[model samples]
Target: MENLELSEGKEGLPYNLLAEKLVLGSILTIPQAIVLASEKLPIEAFYLQSHQIIYKALLLLYAEGKTIDYINLITWLQDNGLLMQIGGTQVLLDLLSQLNQSSNLEEYIALIYEKYIRRALIKLGEEMIESGYLTKIPLETIFTKLERKFFLIAEEKPMKYLVSVEEGLHQILQEIEEGLKLPQVPGLKTTFTDFDFMIQGFQKSDLVIIAGRPSMGKTAFAFTIARNVARNHGMGVIFFSLEMTRQQLLYRLLASEVEIPNTRLRSSKIKRTEWIKINAIINNLSELKFYIDDTPNLSIGEIKLKIKTLGIELSKQIGLVVIDYLQLLEGLKSTDNRVQEISKITRALKKLARELNLPIIVLSQLSRNVESRINKRPMLSDLRESGCISFSLTERTFESILSTRNSILSWNGSSLIREKITHFRITGRKPTYKVQTSLGWSLLISSHHKILTKKGWKRIDKLTLADLICFKLILLSHNKFSITWDKILKITYQDLVPVYDLEISQFSNYLTNHLIIHNSIEQDADIVIMLYRDEYYNKNTVEKDIIEIIVAKHRNGPVGSTKLKFDPKYLRFFNLKDSMKIV
Candidate 1:
């Protein structure tokens, strides 16, 4: 790790002149050495202008599949009319005479590469100093540029290659055996049972697309997955929100985690009791290793640089990356046609995912054409500026969608649901419900009723007192409004009696709802129960706000739809089971 010091001399900069000569001379003496030297050193490695020119000529000969001996080198340079510029035949003869042995070719190449990196650093330092003097440029921007330059220099490691197929196969088999012993093979899980099952958890080096129309809960869904990976699994997460500010994103996360309406938090309207709960939630969340970058109009290069910086700073690998929405990203190069630019952006993101060996969930917007169609569900064609499917879909499903010219009409209820299906074919059982219409969507319904009650009632399975309390707590925390004990009792009775074919009177022996409500702490019950009562009592005045999460594309999983109950008041999302826990 010797530093190549810069010397103040007439020659200008410090460089290993002997090393460059040895590299070129060895290549001339043994033409095969050119291949090895070329892999290690680029033409830029030569500091001397004449040496650079000679290396360029050698590259031209190498590329043309010509021999690189002294005769061919001189002939090529002369034929190209550039022999005299580099000191003519005498220079070539001098280099040939200086050739010692090809054994030290690697050392010469390394020395040249080391000098090249040092020169690059020096140049970078000058640029940074000049940039710092500019008042117009932001300090962070200048630092980012310098960081990228440093990263490029540091990333210049020697090229690697497999020695033999047998060695590669041996490594592969060992990895497979090691993977077999793990319980789940160690990957970032989405925390969704079926979805994780299909995708086998977000594998390393995967680019996942979660596309939908505006206000489709893409951000919420992505946040949920990010939260699970960071909080539950203790893995690091980096979320880049192009549309929303970092504070706004944090507000959403707080609302979801604290189970308090985001409106209340934003307005500073939380009650004393609720504030206590919020404090506890915040304490829990503080333990998570999550990072957020709300930089608008980020280029792929900047994203890479930021990721590298975070990985180094945190000393931990980033498990997941969520880009709030893709359409807002600026490409490396601007183009008049937005579609081509977006295509380039996606391709770069895919490469980044593989390079970083982490799953990148890129949120995307469906085209407005979806609104014009009979069915609003998104198809692959609706992906804004989509070029091709980057991952595999079922062959039959893909072909069916491709062959069918007419829009597919399917039944979800009495209403005929029309879907503008274009890329994926429908397989398996016919969809019972079209919960999500924006992308590859399907819904699942459950019929099993397993209630937890403390006291075993006659004709209906009963739950212990503890079971009842647990159920009540779950119900109270899941919704936005407080519920009366009477409502809880009625809902529980309805859930149990119908399945057991028992009459309502069979549960009359239990304490009345009024008595139970009086015993339970009023603060423990939120407004969600009251909202539920209002829904039935004053249906004409009830307002409902719902967010749909559509699985547009899953690289290693099935594409489908899953619904979560969203309470805009709390800015929270709850699973159907918890939302309807009593029922």
Candidate 2:
């Protein structure tokens, strides 16, 4: 009966109080806790040690304001010399956590006082009891150690709580959503002519990917966008260039911006006028909001922290975030698998874009298989670990194929199909040509293109095998196509005649296999001779038609409709033109 009543009484003690006491008793070592309280730390968060230091530093700043600088703090520390051994700022934070647990400031202070004085006393008293020193020696010796512990606690300072995640998100989100509605940053531009039209703007916090093969100008394109966004738009852009340093990125930007040429930047051959332009550009750049972090192996966590810090420092705002390339990003923490790490990075970036509500532009490398394909142009599958990139994007996903070839079929011999945008065949000697349709340039290749363009040009003709092969060679020759084949053959009827010897059945095999009129590297082969050099295989050509094929795989767009441009080299197409004649 006595035991049961005792158990009931034990259960009645305040569980929260008990837990707090237990936690405080176990983790807060007497030696560590004593050193902190004595410092007189101002703030109250000790979970993170570095955070504690910042809190204490800020308290010092708040107390003295302009009178006390960081250097002053350091100098004071040097004079005291105790600062170096005060367990740094983190200990101060731990102490603050202990003190701030109480609702009332007085109660909190009392609690800290009790812990500083009483806890150490209890510990020493227990040790003395265990060693029989309490009875054998005088209490004065034990009080000395307790006194030392008390002094350390009194000297340490407290740490303040930084803003919580919820609060930070609330404030940042307001800024982000508002920034999106406003006009885009003044100077940011796009290398992709079509992307600029469709995207309308490169708004803040939007995570964009500029993916391509090794030589597809990923760096060039990113630099162009960064320069325009920062320099032209008067918007602050933070370019995290893991691959290049600030000076290198700046040099390339200057080279591209003023049209001075990259080779000149590499060498000392820059003219005086160039220097004048460069200096003026640099001065202009300084006025604009442009920042760069060339730190290599930057993790997504670090990137987020840096961006947050930047946003705090530059009161104006951060309009855009550009990662030189996506693959360079490390995971939040080191991981065993790179692919998994990449996925994590992409997901974080996408979340950041949505959270920040700003556009983020990232560059990525395509697979080497792209170089082996007849169409050197990149496909979604060609994207390195595209599964992660594709899955991460929630809103609009865009693929800008800036190839010399105008038509989709020509892009990869019609392996591409239009899902929404009626891919146009753009070809001509003119520097620029506008294919007018009701849909406008942005909507020309969109789903409504069939109704937008003339009805007669709606249906697309599949190219015959012979025509396809010949077209491939033409693109390869003009540097419009890329393939794995090292050797291209052009055979004439005379050459094939020896193999077939006038057998009609053998002709199909010859045509299907290696039959060609010319034999050499196809890239430099003359298209006219390969097509019309042999009369027997020649077909009378009335118009040099350029076909536009769309190879993009859109999650939501119609598929398979190749558009044709008649005599694209000369004739321009417009629905309201005076003449609809073919070129």
Candidate 3:
């Protein structure tokens, strides 16, 4: 009852007001005792309100390297107006009177932490049981949410100790010495020989992200790695199939293995010889320890639990984990928007990889920003920002307006009437799309490049006939301009050409060709792999069957590209060494 703040958390909350006081008293009594307490206990770990307040003041004084005696602490509290809130000097006097020798500071810190954990557990139980009455929340969601929380509490976290650098170096040296006795391949080996050599195998605790545009075969590529690593190394690989169902995924694998077309297998029109091959390969395929769960809209937390559960059930260590695509994975229910949700998802996946020591491959779609550039090849910048700029090839203009890099243009939403173009850039060759308006105007632009619309800025890829676009109206009578919206009539992809980007002195967007076009839009992925195929864009490319896997970001090794022969008939990727001449 004396320290009611500590004991008042719904009676029987399990708190030691005395332990909290002992720890705080040790810090206030023996200045050196804080050295251990600082590492072991945090301020809130103290249960008593007055103790937490007093501990906070002492820690502040210690951090500032000031004298942490009662005089300095009291002066600090009085100066900060916290001494009275914590019951003034009398509380400090009582703590000093009750505390034993500072030699017991470590145990006192441990006891304080133990009491805090107990209180947290009881509070958690109460919250969970009370939620049982909420009809609005789904039972499965509640369970998954609670499971993540409990896992985090029980997780083993390494504490920092004062070990010398020499001690760490010796352990690392020992590991290298042992590594030399093992096989040449350090991490798990894959089917792609060149890739393994460049990457030194998919190293453990690596979050490798594969990103590409639609129709680029990102999923097929990831499947290839998952299957190859699992089969070649004899280790379990778990695939989180968010987009495709389990059957659909395996069908592609089977088609690739038997050298038969997926269409032929699905229609049951396969030749008798092909059927024999399929039956022959089914047993070998089943023997490989590849696991798949086709759960749609799965959160990162659920994936963790599933992979861990499967690993335990099979009594195997999971070598590789694949998430079909980053965008599809669901995040926790919060007020965060799509961008923030995606950020959380990627961060959580990276953390999960480190926790499980499993190499994770997450597939992602490069943002539309990549389309505006003629290069079309995604830089780390394409993922930076979305929904900006229009690389209009047709360059249609009203009143035959003439403007150059330094030309002045109408500045929207600014006090100034016009702004000069500080600079311009020639974006590499890309297929431009033509958008026609009801006003008999047409402009060629990149497919995914965004332009200002009545609804706000939107990607051209999402535009339809119903949408209205912003355009400048030249007022010849007064030699001025006015802005208005016009309905979109037609849109089509045009031929490839170099695009232009302008830098306005004051704003990001500028008026071009009588249209108020908008301008502008980064990855934390450890390793990034991008997919590209010449045949997707060109009908008569010399290497029609080649798929280029670009190692965009390799944290531990050199970044480069490797060619894999794309067998479209079977939806398979074969190494160049095994395939026909690429040149």
Candidate 4:
């Protein structure tokens, strides 16, 4: 027939017309064949446009629970005005002429699929050739674009199949038995005792989504987890970083590993003894199974391809795959609407996890609504858009300023003066408390906001410590001011409401012989883990060196939180080491 061109004159292009016709013909004869055949092959698997049209009509009718006979197919095609364009009813009737009741439908489906892949490859090659000739485009951009296209094709290879319940149970029993013999629980452990015990570690084929505001130590958590598995258990880690470079990642990882300051490593400040330690660590770490891909704006398809290809190339099984925040990742194709694209991305990543059977950690940004009063800690509602670059926590320097009106007394190096009140704002809503002092002075603030101390700044939460650090405050009495150290008598939790903030002008700061505390603060965040550090909100906070890991979601276990000691000087998060303590 004129409609069934049969790939004639299209010499080099591969497609089997007979296989396509027979598959369509089988569906026409046995309507139920569409069920299995539809799952195995898409309509595009057919060679001719006429067969594709027929297949599309068959799928629609089958989905609607209508009989897939010649009359219905013809009626639907005619109703949709696709009859003549597909060469009318005669074309579909011709497909039925090639039916063989005994033909293995599986064999023919595979055959047509092989041809479809060939056609796809040929199209890909032609597009790549065209792209190569566009001298205006950067070589790197062209290669990445071509690479993503090829991987998307390669990733489409997983076909649907049915497994018996008995088969699934057998695999589960075997894993459960093996798990009992292990020293620790199943899944890779992060060595955080309470934390690891809570989740039973990162399980295989699990899509663990970690989301937080920016600069929240998400990357540090990823590195620490990867290091724990690779160094301790020898399990390989593949980090697909859409942000940060390979050098920067490796540099920070190394710096964190050895407890060396990143600046010290970057600058020419390494001591002779430290050089010995660094060289030894380099020698030790070179053998570990840690891989990093810092390519930015990678799509889910490209990431899957790289991980799969690398797993094959090195023959090393990847235990964990980490994507450094999802906001930076792209969808399969460019789309103007981000919500739809992110939804698509989320589905692809989940599918990749199951197909690869690897524990995947994807970092997402929280929405700006997370900073609002009603929702102090990140709630599930805040994650509807699924994570964030916006919404910073407002760090109010002193409730002492909020205690008074218009202006507050400050030591401007010369003498006590009224630093003009530049601005007053309701920063954010959190679990606030009124800290009552022994000297009849009370200030309302969040529990973790730091106050000036003799040794350093201390959070209001730890005022219960027996050996209290001397807390200083400026007292005003009838236009006369006196600087004196104050101790908190009691901290009473207040209802969730707007936290007041005040900004002072003319560069006024309280200073002592040994320490100085500034007026205002700024915070930033970054990722394996969705962590919230109070210090980011309060720059001079005692918890500044303490990171709180909020398990926003856990597929295998309950959601919870745990703490880690952070060292800003070394840019590392660790347990209670001998030398490290929170200020």
Candidate 5:
């Protein structure tokens, strides 16, 4: 009989034929040993082909409820016509002879499984090398695929023993005792107080599903929680925004933090004052442990691999994992049924959450059927796969309106201007401000703080109509025009608000007398612009843009609804009380 090779490898590869023989021999020696060995070692785990055939025979006998002794094994192999191919009954006898005792079956299984994993790693490395030589696929794609394969191998955990009821009760008692002393939610707290109160923050190993129809603030809500966990808790976050690019997601985050309109930021219509806020926010944002991976068409395996890599790089376990809108994720394999694919994806995500011991927030889109319903609030069934804790957002009102009724000097000052103003009323279906006439031209300065009073005008500290006019002049000047007091005085009344009776000198006098100033408007232009934009330009009416964060399913807590003030201008969600403070 041919002896099994103890050491088998070429070019530093890994294989152990002795471990495979010991595993099979132990099962043959003690027929019941196949039960434990099969759990750890599959048929393919055997290094030698002959041992693989022998193990297959043993499994067949075990499956058929037949004894896995040498006689039954030989008969099974002969019946299957694999006896001679596997070196016949002599090889089976040699396997039984090699078994010193079946007591070390687990150890033998462990050795065989370790060798199998090592071989898998070697194969993966070879595939990676071969893939690098191929020019058709991008190097990033190859790296991601290979890295996921490697991580999947590395993250495999051995089967754990089932806990007894007594042990489980002890653990529960301990947890209850600890809970009484702490009483605080164990996971990261969201910035929104009401939402956090409803869900008790995001729990570990929980798969949180945030679903909404198209144009709903699903991504915004996920981002809000991710930002809060990373910034406030100082925990690492891995946000996989498959729908948007990293730069686009960062822009939204910046807009939310600086309270700048996303549209204005995207259009490069930012004021000089807003730039200062951006600079300050960027400095702080740089310190946050927020990582974004915008890999389009990402699979659950790829997300897991990226999270593992990021956790290692950040030197801390990630507190949260966010996948923007689940429908965008590609499955491992294509299937005829999309619902089945989604079900597999969601199950994989849930498994990943438990494996990583972190909260995973996956955004999903509600079905089109949701739109046809009278109450558009999404239900648990609205989720594509409909598993895991889901939170749906139904827009109770229209998008928030941030209106700035500015009066431009029309060259043709006909009744057409009034007609244009009347036409502008249809744009935003909210309240309209009264038109004011100045210098035979309609002057409507939409100031958040500017109030026309009996004493000419009551200008707040730095946010005055004159200051705002100077800020706009600096913005429109594009740093080409030097900002001087005279220049500001001219732009404030001459261009921005051309009052017929009030002279430039009178406007300058009004600013100097009423507005408190330590530095020139030019010196404070950036801060003034940021303050003005944050207060007025990016403001949202709660009555118009109401985003409801409905907790449709909660594993450890009660299910309910929580309303957050959604600011479409900034693409952000805020707690109602906090938003009122901002207003």
Candidate 6:
């Protein structure tokens, strides 16, 4: 037998024979080896011999499009009398994976030049020493030059930002000018009414956190979003579903996108019609750009590397990334507490968003405290682990928060708007039953300051008692305030004159002047106002719940309701016009 050189795996000396074979065969690319052993190899297992064979086989198979199936691979090795091979087919499989997932060839080259090239040169120097061909002095000079080149690439290349400074300013202006423009792609819409109004729809490079308690459609929502981005916008989307397998995620996506109902899809029960629907939808989906990876217990670094590769493969046209949830993600480095791990994870995600220039939608789990509350509406403070992740890295953090909150409230435009915009005191010192805005006004309180009037202070209840009664009737009779005065009073002038002190003339003036009721004269007359709901009143109390005008924040005009008629459903608060016919 020809003697094969072997060295004991030792402290400083490499397994020279394996390194020589690797360099001579050109079997393994640096990226292939790095990717393969990055996760699986133990500290002691990642030796020169093990990685060498793994890299070479993968490089060959990837380049040639040949496959080494399990049985065939085993038999071939046995025929080569290498059945006892230490770095067997398992190692080779990892190598093949790296090749399949090869993205960022430039980055890989840079990484290789930095990490392995010098080491390769060092190995070459050692070989020179052994072979007695080249001297040690020239090797050192070559190694130094190579090291300089590595640092030059590292220092010169700037990592991509989420938005370039000029582009960021332009984007902010565009967001302000257009509010949130829908993607130019047609037929895409958002399910959440409030979110739709606020964002128009999701934008690229946005790191949106959609968190809820378990089984609150986190995965389902992400799947919906991914489908929308991929199918509608013709944008590439990568979903890293750590909790579910690729097939399971694909099934959920197919069910959601095609409206097959999750149960039918999961049970594999398909009628002829349903199968036709699935086939047609699948064919449509085939035209979309979508990818899924079901790598469980994936670390953040691994995810970043994968995304980087994906960005490269897609020619930097990656539109979105969806991580199922934050807490499930692991960090490359180990930490004692989960909070720290999550903090790291979030930071990495933010970095990934910046790096890839795509919207990264990460699902999160709110604490059980969310469930414990009587109302499960989520607040920004309720965000898990890292509170800072909720805030954007803009110069005006408070301004942006207030602006977004104000926008949501302005669109709501009801008794709820005031309550929604206010920061609630979550201190638990106050009664849980009581609701107050951070501005210290009770949501239950009527707009009029009645106690002062009873104390002989100057009356500020601009409307008389009869007008107040009519306003209450309008608020109670209709779910909205967008009804005309003629519809609201219903009773004739004869009925009003007998019991009430208010005249029709005075009532109209009070509505127009004091209450700020607006009208539309487009067709038949209609009325709209932002009066307090009947729920505000105690029913037993002497004081009735009344509408109040409180300004939040207005960019275009002065902030405040101006006592305009408003509809909670249509969410339109405006002056009554004769033309305010329902469209």
Best by lDDT: 3
Of the two candidates 2 and 5, the one with more favorable TM-score, higher being better, is 5
- Compared with the true structure, what per-residue lDDT tens digits does model 3 show for residues 259-317? 77788778888877676777889989989999999989888778888988999998989
- Per residue, candidate 2 scores C-alpha lDDT tens digits across 1-583 of 0011111113232112322232232223232332233243233313223334433443333323223333444454456554556566454445435532222332333344343344445555566566554566667545544444443443233444347999999998998888788655322354333333334456444455666555334565466567666765676788899988888877766665566766677787888777888888778667867888998877665676688789988876788888877777755545443443565567667767766666777776655555455544444444444222111100111122213232111122322222222222222111111122222211111111111011111201111112222211223444453322111121111100100011110001111111111111111101100001111122353423422222232112222213233222122221222211211
lDDT leaderboard ranking: 3, 4, 5, 1, 6, 2
lDDT of 1 at 496: 11
Looking at candidate 3, the ten consecutive residues that score lowest on lDDT are 384-393
Candidate 3: C-alpha lDDT = 0.71
Q: Which pairs of residues clash in candidate 5, taking residues 3 or more apart in a chain or in different chains? A: 273-526, 439-500
Q: Give residue 211's error in model 6 in angstroms.
A: 0.7
The TM-score, computed over Cα atoms with residue i paired to residue i, of candidate 1 is: 0.58
For model 5, what is the alpha-carbon lDDT of residue 500?
16
Model 2 TM-score is 0.39
Model 2 poorest 10 in a row by lDDT:
524-533
What C-alpha lDDT do the candidate models reach, one value each? 0.58, 0.41, 0.71, 0.67, 0.59, 0.43
lDDT of 6: 0.43
Of candidates 6 and 4, the better by TM-score? 4
Model 5: what TM-score? Answer: 0.60
Tens digits of per-residue lDDT for model 6 on 340-423? 356556655665675566667777765554444554444332444432111111122224334554322111122212212322
TM-score of each: 0.58, 0.39, 0.68, 0.67, 0.60, 0.39
Mark the regions of model 6 whose C-alpha exceeds 4 Å error after superposition.
Answer: 1-194, 385-583
| Full-model lDDT, candidate 2 | 0.41
Which runs in model 3 stand beyond 4 Å of their true positions?
Answer: 1-10, 22-44, 54-80, 92-110, 156-167, 384-524, 534-543, 577-583
- Model 4 scores a C-alpha lDDT of 0.67
